[model samples]
Target: MDELTEFIQSNPDPRELKRALAVQMVLQEYTYFAIRDVLQVSVGFISKWKQAYEIQGVAGLALEHQGSVGYLDNEQRQAVIDWLKAKNYWNLNELQQHLEAVYDVVFASKQSYYELFSAAGISWKKTQKRNPKADPQAVERKKQEITDWLEQHRHQISSGELVVFFQDECHLLWGDLCGYVWGKTSERIEVPMSNERQKQTYYGAFNILSHKFFVQAFEQGNSEFTIAFLQALLAECPESRIALIWDGASYHRSQAVKDYLASVNQGLQESEWRITCIRFAPNDPRQNPVEDIWLQAKRFIREFYHLCQSFSTVKWLFEFVTHRQTFNFPKASMYGLFS
Candidate 1:
C-alpha cells in the first residue's frame, strides 16, 4: 500500500498514476461509490486494477499505452471492429471483456467503447423481433382475408349497427417493472417486488372504426374469462353486433366458449350472429392490432416502474395507459381496416 502511494507521487505518466491511484484507493478501503466519484472512473476500473496489483504487485498497474496517444493501434482497432461485426448480439460489458482479454487493453473512458460500437455500425437501442414460426405467406393471406371481411361489413360498420374490436390477452407480473431508462453504467438498475410471481391477467380490445380501447382485468385468461369479456363487450355496445378479432388461443376456441357464442347467436344466421370471433393467423401475434395495444400498455406501466411498487399500482398504470385511449401506430393499421 505504501509502495503504491510512493509510486503515485513519483511523477510517472498521468495514465500510470491514474491506475496506481485506483489500486491504492481500494487498498485504503475507499467505498467504490466514493472512489468512482473522486476518480471519475467506473467500479470495474477500480476492481480491475486492484486485482492486477494483487496478482502482479505495483508493476501490474502499469498502462499499456502509457506514452501512446491511443490504447489501440489502427490495425488493432480494425480487428476489434471486425470482431464486433461478427457477433449477432452485443453489449458494452461483452465488448469491454473482449478488449481486455484478446487485446490486453482497457480504456479509461467509455467514449472509447462507444466509438468502437459506432465504428462497428452499432448503437444501444431496442431489438427487433421476428418469430421463426411465422409464415410470411400465411400472414399475407390472413391480411387479405381480414381486409375482405372488413369490406363485407362496411354497411353494418358505416350504419353503426356493427362494432369491430381487435382483442388480446396480457398476463402482467409484479416483476414486469423494468423499462429502458437513462441510468448510471456502473450502478445496476433494479426494481423491488415483494412477490415477483404475483401476476394478473387482462383482456384487451381495440376498435378500428371508433379507435377506442377497452380493457378488463380478469383472474385468468381461460374460456370462462373469454366468454365474460365477450359478454361485457357486447353489453357495452348493446344494439350492435360485435366482430371480435383476436389471436387463436386455445381457450378462445374451446368448446365452452363455442357453446356460449352459439347460445348468444342461437336464432340468427351466420352473418347476423350477435358475436362473431375472427382469429388472426395461427402462431402469429404481429397481425393482431390488439397485440400492439397490450404492448403499449405494458411499456407504459414499465416506464413508471418507480411509482408502481405494488401490483395494484401496476394494474392502475396498465389501465390508465390503455383504457379510453385511441391507439395509432404504423403496424396497427397494417391490415388497412382502421381507415
Candidate 2:
C-alpha cells in the first residue's frame, strides 16, 4: 500500500483519512482536477494535502494541526506569561537569562526566545522614561494647583491681559535622526551623516491661550542664558502680564535666576504688568506643553537633516521652520492643567 493508505488504516481518524485519501489519489497519478472531481473536494484542498504530505510525510496528515513544539510546555508558558505581567520591562537577553535560571532551560539563539515571546503574544517596544523618585500624589497636587491658577486668572486670560506660557530647553544634534523611511524592497537607502559634531541648544515657550510659539537659540542652557531668554520673552510681551510655567531645572532655580526674577517681578508690579514664574512638578516633563513643541521641532529637523550642511545652517533652518509653525497648545496641554 502507499504511504497515505497505510497512514489512514493505522490512524483511523476522520480528518486524517480525508487528507490521506487526497494524497493517495495524487500518488495514484490522478491530476488535481481529477482528484477534486472524484473526491468532491476543491483543487486547492487536494493540492494543499499533497504538498503537506510531500513535505512533512505522514505526520503532516495528522487529524489535529499542532504547530512545532515550543521550548516551554503549556504550564511553563503560563508561568512565563504570569512572570512577564508582574514585571514592567524585560529584554530578550534578560528573558533568556531568566528561563535558564528558573526553568533550567537555555535558548540556543535570540531568535528562539524572540519566537517564544511572539508566540506568547508579547511584542518588543520602546520603553518610556519614568523617574523612580517621582511622587504620584505630588504630581496630582501640582496639576490641581495649575488648574486652580488658570481658573483664578480666567478673566485676565480671556481679555488677553495676562498670558500663560510653558517653557523648556532642548539640545538639537547635527546628525541624521535615523528612522524608518520608504525604500525599494531589499535595497538599502542611506542617509548622509554630518561630520560636524556641533549641537544647538534652544529655549522655547508655548503660549497657552493664543497658540503662539517663542524660541531663542543659545550656545548653552544655564542660568545666564535662561535669564537672557526670559528678558527677551518679557520684552516681546510688553502689553500683557505674562505667567511663565517651566520645569525645575537647576538653572531655573539658581540664585542668579531668583535675583533676576525678583528684580523683573518688582519692576513689572510697579508698571502694573506682572511676570510670574511657576515651576512644574519635579521630574514631570509630561506636564509641560513646550516639551511636545520641542519634540515636534526635532522630528521635523531630523526628517530634513540632509538638507543642511553646517551647524549655522541647521540653526537658521530650525529657526525658520519653528517660526512658521504654530503649535496647537490646547491639544497638547496636560490633563488637569488645561482641561
User: All predictions: root-mean-square deviation over Cα?
Assistant: 8.0, 14.9
lDDT of each: 0.83, 0.73
lDDT of 1 at 200: 92
Q: In model 1, what is the error at residue 116, expressed in angstroms? A: 1.0
Judged by whole-model lDDT over C-alpha atoms, candidate 2 comes out at: 0.73
Model 2: residues >4 Å from true position, as ranges? 1-89, 92-121, 180-190, 194-197, 267-273, 308-313, 329-331, 335-339
lDDT of 1 by residue, 1-339 (tens): 788888988998765687788777777798988887787666777788888899999888776554444488899999999999999998887777667645667688999999999999998887767778898999889889998998888888877888888899999888767768667989987887889889999888888787889889999999999999998998899988999988889899899999999899999999889998888887778788777787777778777787876788988888888887888887667766544
Error of 2 at 190 (Å): 4.3
Clashes (backbone N, CA, C under 3 Å), per candidate, total 0, 0
Best by TM-score: 1
lDDT of 1: 0.83
Tens-place lDDT digits, model 2, residues 202-268: 8888777767788888989999999999888878878888888888899999999988878777744
